[model samples]
Each structure stands twice: as structure tokens, then as C-alpha cells.
Target: MPTEILMPALSPTMEEGTLAKWLVKEGDEVNSGDLLAEIETDKATMEFEAVDEGTIGKILVAEGSEAVKVNTPIALLLEEGESADVMDNDAEGTQTTSDPDPQPKEQDGSGDGKASPVTESDTPAPAAPRDDKGERIFASPLARRIAAEKGLDLAQITGSGPHGRIVKADVVDAKAADAPAPAAAPEPSADKAPAAAPAGPSADAVAAMYQGRDYEEMKLDGMRKTIAARLTEAKQTVPHFYLRRDIRLDALMKFRSQLNKQLEERGVKLSVNDFIIKACALALQSVPDANAVWAGDRILKLKPSDVAVAVAIEGGLFTPVLRDADMKSLSALSTEMKDLAGRARDRKLSPEEYQGGTFAISNLGMFGIENFDAVINPPHGAILAVGAGVKKPVVGTDGELTMATVMSVTLSVDHRVIDGALGAQLLEQIVQNLENPMVMLA
Candidate 1:
């Protein structure tokens, strides 16, 4: 029997991907763990690997195909003794043996997991499942139907299948739990029931308004679409508050120059952003209560300072995370940030490189922007938006006016995770670290 090689869900959030390129063609003999294809997900391009040794019997999906759903059969594999002819009847009926779901492999340094390639098996899993909030849940169709028939909630079942997907065997003999009584629907009233949100104008309606005008209509790519959807959800669901602060950067600037001169021999140059990252990392430690993310039901306080920095690319942006940033030297942080940003621009970063962080930094100082509030990336307690450093007059401690280099920053905090006072403390600590640059080294 010919086995169907289904498209894999590389990242936990990936529902579909573009088959960017195929490394193996039909009739090629491949071993387990061999590179099979390049898949372009919403975040980055990743290489898919083979899980079992077999001869490629047929290619079902071609390279450069867009929006290919996960778990769809993309190729066929034949055992040593079998030939391509074995797929003739199977291909006609769209029936073939499929690989069991693959277990998630721990990504290096990235606490998040990535699913491995599937292996030859008897049953096929359905497309990835989703809950009401649109998060992906893995399960087979048979298991779903059985659970529905038994009046059991699939989310409660412990999946024994690969990647922890619920399967028929896991749910067949399970007893249904008691369902909670439904709540009464609230009546719409002027004083009690809230009004529904107004819907946005449709494409046709907007197009009609510009019927006589000439304009270019650009199509949205996967990256752009994901950004739009995620940010929209963030603004709508997350309770956000802002905290603004201004810091004197003259001391930091002088200290940076002195350090750069010594580090010049090692071919290392530190940017102001590097110092900002270190400042935020230390601030998270100083105000440990602010180092947290909002889970659905509770807050997850993280022990390490993992900071994500935004890097703009051709069509979208990537926030590559610097893990354990609080412990790294300034020079090391600079080097790692450069490498991550470079790879991020090239779209070569793995999912783990850009996934988890309790805090993020979005710096537009180089572009000469002066203080702007950034949207809070969900699950992160706060994001710091940095503006340019410019010379400004200020009163010195001795009541004398003097000119100093000042930089403006706004910390967008998630109120659900950090209160206003806690956010202020975090920002104050960051300001203290930046104003007294020598203290950071201590």
C-alpha cells in the first residue's frame, strides 16, 4: 500500500502553508530525517523533513502552491518492494495509508514545541481543529464525531495520539462528563445591554466611493494578513494602558562612546537600542511582579527575562526574542540582536527564534520619530516604544538650566497583567538604568 505524506503543521499556530520548494521528486529514495520540502508559514520559512525511509511514489502537491491546508496528502511513499503502480488505484479513489501524527519536538532554547514529521500508520488524522477563539487543536474526524455523539467535550479529553491529538482509540470508551446548565440570554435594553460593535465598511462599499479615482489595489500576503488579524484582536480584547517617561541620555551616550573605543578592537559596536534592551531586561528583574503574561484564567510569571525586539522586513515585521537576556553581557546582547535581526529580515528565523516573550521593544528612534505608543502584543505584559534622542534644555539639580540629550519612551502595559503603579515602577527602573549607565555594568 502506498502511504500518503500529509502536509505538516510545523508551528503550533500554523493551519496552512505555502509549499515553497520540494527537495525530493518522485522515484527518489529518502531516509528518515531527510529534508523533503521548504514550507513558508505566516512567520518564517522552515524545512520539512521525512519521518520514514521509502521511495517517493508520486507528488500530489506542486511547489509554490499557496494556502495548502495542513494534513492534506502532498506526496506518496512506497515500501522497498512496492512500485509506483501500487498508487494507481489509491490515487484514483483518494484512499491511501497515512502516517500517524508526529509528536512535537522541543525546539532549542525556545520553550515552544514544533511538530515532527509523521510516520507510516493505519489511520489518518483530519485537518487541525480550532476552538471558538480560533486557536488550533489537533484531533481526528472519527474521534470528533464519536465525542459529539457521546455529548462529551473534546477539549477535556486527553489525546494519546502524536502531538497530543485526540484519536478514536482515546475517546471510544471514555464517559461523558456532566454539562453545565446554559445561562439565560439577556434582553436588549438601552440601560442594561451593551450595543453591538459597528461593522466596518465592506470592500464593495469602499470601492464604489473611489470609482472615479485611480488607485492600486495590493493583495495581502500571509504575513500581512496575520499581522492585521492579530493586532486587531489585541486591541479589541486586551485591556491596555500607557505610561510615558523621558530619560536623560547624555550620560549613557558618553559611557557608550568610552566603551565602544575599547570594544573597537574586537569589532563590536553597541547601539543605543542595545542599552535599552539591557535596561528593560534589568527592569523586569527589579519589578518581578511586572514580569508576567496573562493566561486565559491566570497570570504566568516568568523567571527569565526573554525580550522580543521588532525588526521590519519587506512586507511585514518579525519580533525575534532574546532569551535569558538579563544574564548576557552588553556586547553579547548586541551581537545576538544583530544576528537575530539579520536573519529576521532574510525570513530565515525558525518559529522558536521569534515566538515567546513576556516583554517586547519597538524602536523607531533611528527614523527620527519622537515618542509614539505601540500596541501591546498579546501574552506580553508590556512593550516599550522608544523615540529619538535629541538635545533639549532642562533644569539641572543646582537650579541652573542646561542642555542635555533626552529620549522619550512610552510603555504600553496590559492592565490585566500589570497595574498602573507596577507599570510605572517598571518604567522608572528602566529610566534609572539608562540615566545612570554605569549602574548597569555594576
Candidate 2:
């Protein structure tokens, strides 16, 4: 039988993506782990790999196709001794090529009446699990892993994913029933439905408001759309509070100058932002209680100091994380950050490279922005908004006025994860590290 190769979800939040290019054509023989296509997701452009060895029977979706939904059949794979005729018969009279709709009839979201076309094989292709009645169970790989770990039966649980496939949310919700239920709210009456949050205005409505004005309407890309949705959700749902502090950077500037001179021959010049990253990473270790993220029902406190640094790209931004940043030296941190930022601008980073961090740093100091509050990225406990350094007059220890380099910073915190006191302590630790730059090496 011919197997359908579906469009993959490159990232967790990706529902659809642009099929930028295809490496294999019809009748091309592809082995497992071979590069198949380049998929442009909301975050980056990633290469898709073939999971099974087969001959490409047909290419359903064309290159440069945008807004193609995940799991929609993009190509057809023929097994050994199989020909193109098998695809038409196996797909139940569906067109083998040039058909915009390539999804099989069984996966039309009408419930699991028949088995999925993707069957189990020795290779690492997407395999369909079977129920007790021998009916095929459509589920994601992550969902299946979670179900196995929890000792749950797939047949007993209902799927709410695309095309009725089981996803991680469905598995987690199914496991919740085994535990004690929380307090329930009163159900709404039949006539009185719950009110939805206002989504500002429709495109038509907004255009009407600007009828007389001359403006070019730009379409939102995947990156822009994701940024708008996630930030909107973060502002509305997360209970955010701001904490501000001013740190004297005289000692840090002196230390940085000395280190740069010594490291000049090695081609390593550390920036103020590099010092800030090290300071924050060390601060998380010093105030471990503040290093956490808000799970739905609980909080997850992480042990390592994984820090995400925001890098602005052409359309949007990417926050590539530096794992175990506290263990790295300033020179190493500078090099890694430069590489991450460069790749981020080129949209070549993988999903794992830009995700999973307890905290983030958004530094607009280079642009000469004095100070501004930053929005907290979801699942992160906080984000530090750093401002430019300026010369300011301050009182010396002997009560004499002296000039020193000062930088302003604001910590946007999720109250659910870190309290006011804990956030303050974390900020204090950061300020201390910056003021006493030599202590960071110790």
C-alpha cells in the first residue's frame, strides 16, 4: 500500500507552515534520515527528514505553498514492488497527484471509523496504534509516550486533536480524571452562553475606520501572528508585576575593558550584554526560588540556569536559550551568544535552540533606549528589560558627589511563580554581581 507523508508540526505551537521547498521529487528513492523538505515554521526554517525508505510515488503539495495545515498529506510513498496504481486504489479513488485535497477519507475528522493509511513498519514512520477491538488509534508520538508512561488505555480515551488524533493535552486531561476533581463552577444556562473576549476589530471594520487615510496594509506572517497571539495571551492571563532597579556599572565597565585588552589577541570582545547574561545566570543560582515557571496546576522549579536572550530579526524576534549558562565563562558566553544571534537572524535555528527557558533577557541598550518594561514570555517566570548605560552623578562613600556609569533595569515578573520579595531578591543579586564584577569569576 502507498503511504501518505503528512505535513509535520515543526514546533509545538505550529498549526500550519509554509512548504518552502522539496528536496525529493516523484520517483526519487529516499532512505531513512534523508532530507526531504524545508519547512518554515513561526520561529525558524527547519529541514524535514524522511523516516522511511521508499520511492516517492507522487508529490501532492507543491513547493512555496503557504498556510498548509499540519497532517495534510503532502506526498505519497510507495513500498517495494508497489506502483502508482496502488495509491489510487489504496486512497479509495482519490487522485494521486494534482489534487489540492490529499487527506484520506478516514482522516476527515469524522471520528475513527477506519484505520489510518500510515501503518506500522520497521522504519521510524508515523505508526498508528490499535485499540482493543483492533481499530486503529491515531495519536502523536508524544501523546503515545505519555499514555504509556501513565499506564492509560488509548481505546478508553477520546481524541480532540486534528483529524481526531490524540495529542498531549488530551492524554493529560484523561489522566486528570483518575485523581480527585477540583471545585467545579456552575454551568451556564442553555440560553445564556459565556461571553468571549473582544478580539479588537475585524479586518473589514478596521479598514472602514481608515477609509480616508492612505496606508498600505501588510499581511501578518507566521512569526508576527504567533507573536501577537502569545503576547496578547500573556498580558491578559498572567498576573504581572514590575520591579525596577538602578545599578552602578563603573566597576563592570573597568573590568570589561581590562578583559577585552587581554582577550584582544583571541578575537573575543565581551559586551555589556554578555556581562548581564552572566550576572542573571548567577543570580538565578543564588536565588533558586525565583528560577521557576508556572505550570497550569503547579509550578516547576528548574535546577540549571538556562537563560534565553532575545534577538531581533527582520520580521520578529527569536529567544535562543543558552543552557547551563552559569557554568560558562564570559568569553564562551560571548561567542555562543554571537552564534545564536546570527543564526536567529537568518532563521536557521531549530525549535529546541529557541525554546525552554525559566527566564529571558531583552536588552535594548544598544539602541539607546533609556528604560521600558518588557512583556513576560509565557512559561517563563520573568524577563529582565535592560536599558542603556549613562553617566550619572552619585554620592561617594565620603558623601562627595562623584560621576559613575549607571544602567537602569526593569524586571517583569509573573506573580504566580515569583512573589514580590523573591523577585526583589533576584534583582538585588543581579545588581550586586554587576557592581562587584570580579566576584563573578570566583
Candidate 3:
């Protein structure tokens, strides 16, 4: 029997991705766990693996194809001794185009009416846990695992997945609905209307406005489109509030100078941003109430400080997180941040390296920006925008004027998660940690 090789979802939010490269070709004999292709998601390029051993019968989707939706058949695999006649008939009956419509596969002469893994039915009949004979249940591997963990019986649940395959979501919904008290923890539901901004004018219509004007049209890539969509949603849905503060950085500068000299032999030169990362991490711990993220319906307060630092790249930017930053020394943070930033610029980072941070830091200080507000990334409670440190006249303890290095910072808080008072307290702790560098060491 021939099996359909569908496009695998590389990330949780991945709907479509680019088929960057195909490592296998038609008639190539492949075994389970073999690498078949390289899938380029929005964040990273990940290798796609084969789950069942078979011979590559055909390459349905070509390499370099972009926006290939998840679960779209990319190729076909045939078991040993299976004839190409089985595949030729299948391909002839199906349409092959940029938007291929999923069609069912021919039955393999098995008396059972259950469809094979290669066959896809868009509007499949609901899957029963057991057949008429009361044999073992037919379910997806992920579905079985989730059902076991949730203590739910697969035989009692109906599947809505492709070809009536029991999927992870089916089991999760069943378990949640069957729980003792459903209202206590309501399952997250999708909004009836998408939160996306209304569609803009057609490309031709927009071009008409600039006709006779000098302008070069630049097409947007995957990275640019993703950035646009995400930022738009953040501004429209997330209620954001700004908290401003100014901290004297004279002490941090002097301390950083001394530390850099000691770490010079180890090739670890610390930067002001490194100290900022450490300060933010410790502040999260000092004010644990602020160490939280908006988890759809609930707030998740984390014990470890995973701090994401924004690094600008060619297309857009990447926010690679440093896990447990509060527990690491200044030199360690400097070394780790440099490595992450280098890989990020080269587009070599994996999804895990750049995802899931409770908070983030974006410093345009090195660019000489005085002060600016940063948009809060979704699911994150807040983002710290740090500005350049400049010398300014200040009143001393004895009421005398003196010059000190002052850095302006703006904390962008998600009003849904952090209140105005709580945001102020969090900013105060960050400033206190930066003003007294020795306390961070302690």
C-alpha cells in the first residue's frame, strides 16, 4: 500500500511552511527515522523525519515551494513489493497543483473498511473506538498517549482527524468535558471571529495611488509577514501600559569596567546589556508577582527567569532566551548572549532557543537612542526597553549638584496581567538592582 507523506507541523503555531529542500528522491529506499526533507518554519529550519519504513514512490510537492499548508501530501511512500500501478492510479484521480485538494486513497483489499494511513478524507466519517468485532482501538500514536495520560478511554471517544484518525485534540476535549467540574477550568476556545485586522485594499488598487510617483515595490518574505501579523495583533488585542524610570548608571559602569578587566584573559568582555539582563532576571525574583505571563485565560507565574533579548537580524529580528539568567554570573551571561546573538543573525537557531520567555529586553542604547517604548510580545507580561546612558546634572545627598550617567528605561506592561501599581513596583526593583551592582552578586 502507498502512504501519503504529509507536511508535518514544525511548531505549535505553524500552519504553513516552506519545503526548503528534499533529501530523498523517488525510488529512494528509506527506513524509519530517516531524514526526508528540511522544513523552514518562521523561526527555524527543521528536519522532517520518516515514521514508517518504505520506498519513495513520488515527490508530489517540489522543493522550494512556499506556504505549503500543514497535512498537505508532499510525497508518497510504498511498502515492499507494492506496484507503481497502485500509485499511478492514485495520482491520476487526484489533482496536483499549488493548492491540491485532499482525496481518499483506494482500499488495499483488506476486508476491514478502515482507511490506510496514506488515504486522506477531508470530510471523514466519525471514527469509532472499536470495530464491530470489538478488537483493539484504532487511534493515532499521539492520541493514544494523551488518552492514557488523561485516563480517558479511546473506545468511548469519536475522532474528527483525517480519515477518522483519533488525534491529540480529540482526547483533550473528551477528557476536559468528562472532568468532574468543567466550569472550574474551562478549555480554551477559539474566537468565532479572528482577531486579524480587516483586509487592506487590493495590491492593484494601492499601486494606483502611487502611479507616476517614484517607488520600488519590495515583496515581503515569510519573516516580514509574520512580524507584521504578530505586531498588529499585539497592538489591537493586548492592552498595554508604559512605565518610565531613570537610573543612575555610574556605579554599574565602574563595576562593569573592573569586571571586564578581570575577565579579559578569559575572552569575556561584559557589555551594559549583559548587566541589564542580569538585573531584570533578579528583579523578577525579587518581585515574583510580576514574573508572570498571560496564558490565554490564566496567568502563569514562573520560578526560573528565562529572559529573551531582542537581536536585530537582516530580515527582521530574533529574541533568543537565556534560561535561568538570575542564577548565572555576569561573565556567563555575556558569553551565552554573544553565542545566541551570533546564531540568531546567521539564522541557525532552533525554535526552542528563541521561544517561550516570560519577559524580554530590547536595548537600542548602543544605537544612541535616548528613550523609546517597545511593544509587548504576546504571552509575555512585559518588555523592558533600555536607552543609552548619558551624563546629566543631578542633586546629590547633600543637596549639591553633580554630574552622573543616567539611563532612561521604559517598561511596557500588559495591562491584562500586570496592574499599574505592580508594574511600577517591578520597574523600581529593576532600577534598584541596577543602581547597586553588588546586590546582584550577592
Candidate 4:
């Protein structure tokens, strides 16, 4: 039988991706572990590998195709003893169907004591339906029944099930689209008509206004689109609260300078941001309850302080996480952060390198911005926005005045998981860690 090469889901949240390029063409012989194509997800461009050895019989999707759905066949493969002619629509009719339900695990008397393989007789009656165009549209019987009930066009909906087979969820979404809107009110006189509600201008209206403007219009790419969507969702759904504090960086500066001087031989120079990362990690340890994330229905308290640092890239920024940050040395954290940031700017970071962190740190100090509130990244309990350090006069504990370098930071807390008191405690620990820099090393 001819096998189909389906599009793969590169990331957990990826629904569709661009088929960036194909490494093999029709009639090319391929083996397992061979590079099949390059798929560009919203986060990164990943290389897809062949899982089965076969000859590329047909390429259904062309290169540069956007929104190619996961599990939709991108190509057809001719297995051993199969010819290219097997890809004909007539051959599809002879394809065998398997049972959708799981078979009872009957243990065989073999020494391995494994369950027997399901047989063809186990297949239930009524195979998948075909479209009027004489093409096989893989859909479950329930989905077809629901589409019939709602009079929905099954061909228009994209399937998210295994092998791109239409499922119940897809049918529900399609049915929702087919729902009719409420009838409009009867037209009234000019004086009686209600005034239009205030809202943002439409895309067409804005474009008309900027038609003669002296500016270049740039289109949003995949990364920018994802960032906009995620941020918008975060702001709309997550209840946020902000806490601000000013920390004296004199001790951290002196400690970093002395360490850098001794480590000059090893070429390991630490940055202030590196110290911030470590301090946040230790603070999470001191206040473990605050080291949590807001899952949809529950809060997840973390054990290790996995810290995500925001690194700005060309089109969008990447938050590469430093895993088990509390256990690593300051020098190790600095080195890892530098490598991750470098890869992020080059668009070469993997999804695992930039995803899943309990907390985040966004430092705009390099840009000379002073204390701004940052939006809480979803799933993270809070994010610390660090501002530039500047020399400011402060009243000393001995009733005297002195000049010290102070950095202002704002912690944006997700009220769903972190309360005001807990957030304040976490920020207080971070301040203490920064003030007494030697305790962090211990």
C-alpha cells in the first residue's frame, strides 16, 4: 500500500506551519533518518526527518505553502513492491480500513506474553465517506452525522485529528460558523437611529488614512503575529497587579567587579543581568509558594527555579529559559544565557530552549528605560522588569547621606496565582539578595 507523508506538529501549540522547503523531490529514494523537509513554525524553523524508507511518489503540498495543517498529507510514498501508479484514486478504494476501537488485550501463550495483533475482521461496518468530487474525505461516522444535522460543508473545515481525519470537535466548530446571526433592528429615521458605538478603526479605514503618509508599511510575520496574539490574550484574560521596588546595586557591582578581575584569565565576565537572574532564582527558593504558575484551572508550584530571560530579536523577542537556575553557578548562568541569547537573535533556537518557565525577567536597562510595568507572560506567576541603574542620593542607616547606584524594578504579578502579600515577599527577598550579594554564593 502507498503510505502518506503527513505534516508533523513541531511544537505543542502548533496547529499549522509553513512548508519552508522540500529536501527531496518526487521519484527520489529516501531512507529512515533522512532529511525530508524544513518546516517553519511560529517559534522556529525545524528540519523534518523521514520515518520510513520509500520512494517519494508525489508531493501534494508545494514549498512555501503557509498554514499547512498538521497530519495533512504533504506527500505520498511508494513502499516496497508498490509502483507510482498505486497512487491513483482508484487504488484508494482498495485500501483496507481498521477498527477505530481498541481491541481486548488477550495475552498469547508466547514466552513474551504479548497481546495479539488486531485483525481485519475487527473493523466495524460503514467505512469513511467520500466527497462528491470523487475524492476520499477521511471523517468519522459521527462527524458526518453531525455535519448532516447542521447542513455544514465538511470540505471547508480543517481537521485536527490523527492523519487529518475529521472529528467531532471539528464538526462542532464548523456548525458554530454556520449559525445565523440575530436579525437586525428595523431602520429608523436619521434623528431616531442610535449613534454608532466608539471602537477602533477598521483595517481598511486606517489604510485609507495612511495612503499619502511618508512611511513604509511592513507586514506582520509569523513570529510577530504570535507575539501579538499571545500578549493580547494574556492582557485580556489574566488579572494583573504591579509591585515596584528600588534596590541598591553597589554591593553587586563591587562583587561582580572583583569576580571579573579574578576570572579574567578564564575569559568569564559576568553582567548585571546575570546577577539578577541568580537573585530571582534564589528568591523563588526562599519563597517557594510564590514560585508557581497559573494553569487554566489550577496553580502549579515549581521545585526548581526555571527562569526565563527575555532576549530581543529582529522581529520578536524570545524568552529563553535557564533550567535549574538555583543549582548552577553565577558563571555558568552567564555563559548559558549568552549562548541562548545569541542563538535566539539568529533564529536558531529550538522550542525546548525557549519554552516553559515559572517566572520571567525582562530588563530594559540596556535601552535606558526606567521602571516600566511588563505584561505577565501566561503560565508564569510573575515577571520582573528591571530598569537602568543610576547614581542617586540615599539616607544612610547612620543618619548620614551618601550616593549609591540604585536600580528600580517592577514585578508584574498574575493575581490569579500570586497575591499582593506573596508578591511583596518575593520582591523583598530579591532586594535582600542583591543588597547582600555574598549570601547568593553560599
Candidate 5:
């Protein structure tokens, strides 16, 4: 029997995507997860992978085809030893725009499920412990092969990684602490860090990265087209006003450091993003209007704090949701965030991973960004922007000057459902949570 690879819905709002480029040609043997093509969604150009093993029987939609619709068969997979009947079948059922409904491929909330390596349902039972890199190892990363040859117990040595994952740094650090170690690090180089923001790459520079290949471009696919239309509509129609604030982060930074020290053994390291998410969720409960979507003439208030975090992909972006952000623990949120982000980058996210957001957060702190305003992703009235925290001077209670970590945040509000006062009130509550460093727990 032949297999038909159908077009996947990249986002809930996505009706179609452009068949950006095909990686395999007819007669190319492919296994599950072999890169098949690149799809240009409004948010990004994602690589599509083969879901089942087969040989490419025929190519239906040539590269740069923009006239494709959802459920359209773009390629045919021929079984081994089977004559090319697959293409004939696909051509027989040539998808039509006239059909309003086609059975949609199973989609989860975060991304398209077509090219996934594995799903939660297929996840094998946990196997015996593997090394930090998930490979079998006789000795710890620190103990070295000498220790492995001597059958030394790495568990006896204290670890530096969460849950003792045993990174090489921990072993060397342990060695250095045990005995005054040789200086290995090079002296800091002058101009190591640039003072000014770097300029965005020009067309020439980006084109050079492709090794001088003249690449063909195509029209935006259904997802990108819809995204362009919707976001454009939002920016144009939605009355957007932003409130910016700088927050003292000394307490929050200390809280994270202290919490990581306690939880490292349990494999949990709290990130600042987790606290930000928690604070947003907690603040939403008190400021219910922020947790709402402007549905035509009325506001749809959400009962759950489903906070979506925008993740950047190759061409566009995807916002994988952190469902019930307020109900989850910091560790849980951290784990989920890692899983969601990893799967998102891999282009294996499900539809549910991208839906159900009462509020949204877009943080650029990891990139050392100081501050930025975010575009409001709709149905959600508010989106928060979080910036990096850096140590700075501050006045103490006793009239003494001290150093404190400070962060900047900006809240973009849809003015139709919110007033300046209401937006300010929500921002103030979020600030309180960050300042306290413990309100997140509540």
C-alpha cells in the first residue's frame, strides 16, 4: 500500500502553508524523520519530516508552490517493491479548494504533529540510567577514563549539575577546590564585549551565509498569510497602548540562586522566566480584565491562566502555551518550558501547545536585551515584555547606597478592553511579585 503525506496545519489559525522546498526527490529512500521539505508558515519556515519509511514515488507540488491548500497531497510515498500506483491514487483524489472540509491531520496545541520523532503515547518506559549525554558510560564525566579503568565510584564525589547529571565542569571544579589548580583560563581579552548593539545583518551578509547560492523565494503559505492578515489587523484595529516600568530584581535574583542551590540535587533549577510567568498568572487573578480576549463586541474572560510564550523559529515564530501557568510549580513550568521549546524548535509541537492563552509573555532577557515592547497576540488583551537584570546602585533603607539587580518590563495592552489605570494596576501587581520574590509561590 502507498502512503499519502498531507499538508499539516502549522497553527490553529493556519488554513494553509506554502510548500517552501522539497528536500527529497523522486526515488529517494526515506526513513521516519528524514527531512522531506521546508514549509513557510507566516511565523516561520519549518522543516517537514517523513512520518513513515518509504521511497519518494513522485512530487506533486513543485518547490515554491503557493496555491496549495490544507489536506492537499503534495507527495506520494511508494512501498518497497510496489509499482508507482501511489501517484496515480493521489492524482485521482487531487485535493480541491471546492471542498470546504477535509479531515484534518491530528494537531496538538503547540505545533504540527506530522513529523514528530515520537509522541507522549509512544514514549518508551524509562530505561536504566544513562550518562549526562544520554549515553552509556562506565565512569563519571569528572572521574575521567583513568577512574573508569580503576572502577572508581563517581557518586562519592559531589556533583555540580542538577540531580548530579555530572558535567565535566563540576569534576574540574571539584579538582580545583581540592587542590590549588593550574591556571587554565586565558586572561580576559580587550574589547571582549561590544559596548554598542550590533547592527542587523544586511541582505549581503545573510546571502553569504548560504554559501553564495541563489535561492528561490515563494509566496507566504496559509499560516503566514493568515498570520500576516490577523496580526496586521490587530496592530491596525486594536487600540494598543504600552506601559513601561523598571523593577528592582535583587530579591528575585537572590531567590533564584537560593532556590537552585536547594533544588539542584532534585534536578530543578528555577529560571527567572518561571517567576515572571508565575507573577503574570497571579496578577491576572486580581486583574481579570487582563485575562480576557476581545471577541468582536464582547470580552471573553478566561477562567484559567494559560500563558503563551513566543518562541522564534527559522522564518517566523510560534507561541507554545504554558497551560494553567498559575497552577504549576516553578520546577514543573521549567520542565514543560524546556520540553515545549525543544519540541517547537524541532517542529514537532502539537496544536494544544499553541492554544488557550489567557495572557502571553515574550522575554528577551536571555539575549542580554535591556527592554522591548511586544506585539499583542490576540484574543489575549495583554502581553508582557521582560528584559535582562543587571546589577546597579540603589539607596538602602538606612540611607546607604547598595548594589541591586534591576530589570525593565513593558506591558502592551489592548485599549478597547482596558484603561490606563487598569493596565497600571496589573503592572504594579506584577512588580510586587518580582520585588517580593515569593509572591510567585502564592
Candidate 6:
């Protein structure tokens, strides 16, 4: 007996998907748990897997075809000597009787038995060449699906993304394949001449011709809807202010270098961000008001110092909650943070991983960013942005001025929840804790 490979439901928000690329070819040996295809859903490109092992016999759905429903028979796997006859008998809204020999129709042709448009293009225009080597592409799933359904070639599109990667809006507004450029309409004829073909069709007629496609509106997945609601509420409701301070980090850098060298045998590689997280946690203890949330008609102060650290993911971003940060060791926080971030990018995080916090941190320093203000993670009075530490000059005691490593930290605060004094006091603690790692250990 042969096994069928169904189109997978890649994400909770995904009702339909486009076959981005097939990992296995027809007649290829497939193993259970092997990645089968890359599926483009509404949110992101996800890998679909095979659960049953066998020889892959056919590719039922072509790549770049859109709106393929979940569980649709997408491919088939066969035992030795098994035929691809099962699909042949049931294809194109037809079925055969038990005794009838099924004939398989070749699916190599387009609607009119013509070659596919993908292969027909000899060369793209100079200004619109497609990315043959799509190394840094970033198209949204919805856009890819829409492009596929309409046969709009993505390669021919000049991507408007930062690095020229094709994005969703580019596909939606793409003109039809081989569509003539919109020409200026000829003027209507005078009494001496015949009336010209109604100039540019009336506006209503043009609009009707280009009406949007019919689509079934689906409910947002738990993750997407939650992201939207939270970000919107945070931006609209929170009264945010920022305070920036630069720390001379010559000691901290030397300290980290020495600590890592000594602990190299101990297997703990402490990142600067890890030190910052620990510092913030300890700082929250001394100025507890900074580690609190603002609720309707009351302020809910928290203990134990729960911190939400922002993690950027494929679809928007989420924060992983590091519970009782003030109580955890630097190594423990480092380990947990790595686990939470790994699971977050893989979309395997539970609600608890993202929810609840007294303070938050977003670090773009490793990416070489010098300064940025972060949006407050809700319920948390402040979110901290950590920048790259650089070499600078600082005045030291004993009337000595010297070059030192320095880092800039920015705190975005919700004014209603935390006053300027409390915010400043907490910042001082954070600075001190980072400067002296031994203090954070206590």
C-alpha cells in the first residue's frame, strides 16, 4: 500500500499555504522525520516534515501554487513496485470503477496546454532582474501566495526591502504578466470625426475590471492576535519617557575577559548582555518602585524581580520572561535565556515564556547598534536598551584622565507608573551593579 503526504498546517494562524520549495524529488528516498518542503504561511516560511518513510513517487502540487488547503494530498510515498495509479484514478474530479485501468494525465502543461510562465521568460528587464540566488530574501507568506495565485513572478520584482528583498506589498500591487503599460487615453472625437474608443474605459469600468479577488477571512492565530493587541495597547496607553546614561566600562570589559578566561575550563561563557541582565535584576531590588506595574486605579508593586527580555523572532517579536531574576545566578539566567530565545524563534514558547515582567531589556548592541529607545513591555514600568561598549576617554580620581571602554544604556519609562526620582535611583543601582559584578553575585 502507498502512503499519501498531506499539506501540513504549519502554524495556528495558517489555513492555507504555498509550497515554497520541495526538499525531495519524485523517486527520492524519504525518511520519517525528514523535512519534506518549505511552506509559506501567512506569518512565515516553515518547514513541513514527513512522518512516514518510503520512496517519494510524485509531487502533486507544484511549487508557488497558492491557497493549498491543509491536509490536501500533496505527494505520495510508495512501497517497492507500487504504482502512482492511486492519484491517476482520482485526479481532476473523476474516479474509476474497481475493474477499470486508470490512465494518468501528464500535468506538465498549463491551462491551455502551454509551458509555464516561469520558464518562458528569456531575460528580465535590466531594472527588474529577479534574484537568482535569493540569499537575503524576506517576502511575507501572504504576498508570496498572492503572487503565485496570479502568476506574478517574484524574481521580476525589484524588492523594496532594506536589502532589496521582495516584500508583500510589492507582490499585491504587481501588474499581470505581459500586461501592457497604461497608455494615455486618446481624446474624444469632434463633430467632424467618429467618437474614439471610450477614453480609458470609464473610471467605474476600470475599477470593476481590477476588483480584488474573493477571499475567505479567517481568525488570527493566538500568537498574532496577542501581538497586535499588546503592542497597540502599549503604544496608545503608556506615557513613555527616556533617560540615557553612559558607563565607563574599562573595568567591566577587563573583568569579563578575565572571568571568561578563568572560567573557560568551567564551561560558562558569560555575555555582556548576561551581565547587564543580572545588573538590572539586582538594581530592581534596591529601587523596588522601578520594578512595578501600573494597573487601573492602583499600582501593583511586585517582588522577586521578574524581568521580560525582548527577543526578535520571524514574525514580529516577543519577550521571554525570566522569573525571579534577582534570585538566579548569572550562569542560570544565561542558560535559561538561551533556551527561551531558541524556543521563541522556533515558535515553541508557551504563554508563560512571554507574559509577566517587572522590567524588560532589548539589546541590539551585538548587532553594532550604538543607541536606541525601546517600547515599554506592558505592565513593566521600564524597558532598558543596551548598546555596544566602545573605547572612550573618562576622568578618573586623583586628577587622572584616561581612555576607557564605555557602554550607553537607555531606559524607556512609563511616567504614570514610575516617577523620575525612582527611575533615576534604579538606574544608578544598575550602573553600580554592572560596574561591580561581585555585587550582582550577592
Each model's TM-score, in the order given? Answer: 0.79, 0.80, 0.80, 0.75, 0.59, 0.52
Clashing pairs in 4: none
lDDT of 3 at 184: 16
Q: After superposition, how far is residue 337 of candidate 5 from its true place, in Å?
A: 0.7
Runs in model 6 deviating more than 4 A are 1-229
| Per-residue lDDT of model 2, residues 42-70, tens digit only | 88898987655679998888999887766
lDDT of 6 by residue, 212-275 (tens): 9674545454345446655666777899988899987767777788878977896888888888
- Output the better candidate (1/4) by lDDT: 1
Q: Evaluate all candidate structures by whole-model CA lDDT and list the values in order.
A: 0.78, 0.80, 0.77, 0.76, 0.67, 0.67
Candidate 1 overall Cα lDDT vs. reference? 0.78
Return whichever of 2 and 4 wins on TM-score.
2
- Mark the regions of model 4 whose C-alpha exceeds 4 Å error after superposition: 88-200
Candidate 3 local lDDT, 153-224, one digit each (tens): 665678665435555567767753343211111222343223223368988999999999999998877677
Q: What is the lDDT of residue 73 in candidate 5?
A: 58
The window of 10 residues in a row where model 6 has the poorest summed lDDT is 107-116
Q: Rate residue 193 of model 4 by lDDT.
A: 12
Compared with the true structure, the alpha-carbon lDDT of candidate 4 equals: 0.76
Clashes (backbone N, CA, C under 3 Å), per candidate, total: 0, 0, 0, 0, 20, 1
Error of 3 at 244 (Å): 0.6
lDDT, candidate 6, equals 0.67
lDDT of 1 by residue, 132-171 (tens): 4544455544565466567666656787755576666677
